[model samples]
Target: MDKSVELLKLGSKIRELRMAKGLSQAKLGAIVFKDQQSIHKVETGEFNPTYIYLLEICEGLDITISELLDFKK
Candidate 1:
């Protein structure tokens, strides 16, 4: 798949997990030491997160990197 498509899928997966955990963008961002706008950009696939940011997001979501990238569902 294209890189953009991959980003979109990753964003969707993050959104799904965030929703499942009852987290708002602001809350998630706070946990990740970012802003609501950053979270928004992330979830919309408008920003390419750095590896550290991705690690922070996974940690904030209480999930592993493998879980975050698991698109089989």
Candidate 2:
């Protein structure tokens, strides 16, 4: 798979999980100490985040990295 496509899928997963948790981008960003714009970029696949950044998002989502990347649906 292409790297951009992978990122887009990851972003979609993050958005899905965030919505499931009833958190807005700003709410999740506040929990993770990121700005809403940054969260928006990630959710829109406009930014490639670092490993730690992903971990931070998982933390804000109250999910493990495993859960975040499972994509088993």
* Model 2 clash tally, residue pairs: 0
Deviating ranges (above 4 Å) for candidate 1:
none
lDDT of 2 by residue, 5-65 (tens): 8888889999999999999999999999999999999988889999999999988898899
What TM-score goes with each of the models?
A: 0.95, 0.94
lDDT of 1 by residue, 1-73 (tens): 5988888888999999999999999999999899999998888889889888999999999999999988997
lDDT values, one for every candidate: 0.92, 0.92
Off by over 4 Å in 2: none
**Residue 33 miss distance in model 1 (angstroms):** 0.7
Deviation in Å, model 2, residue 65 alpha carbon? 0.4
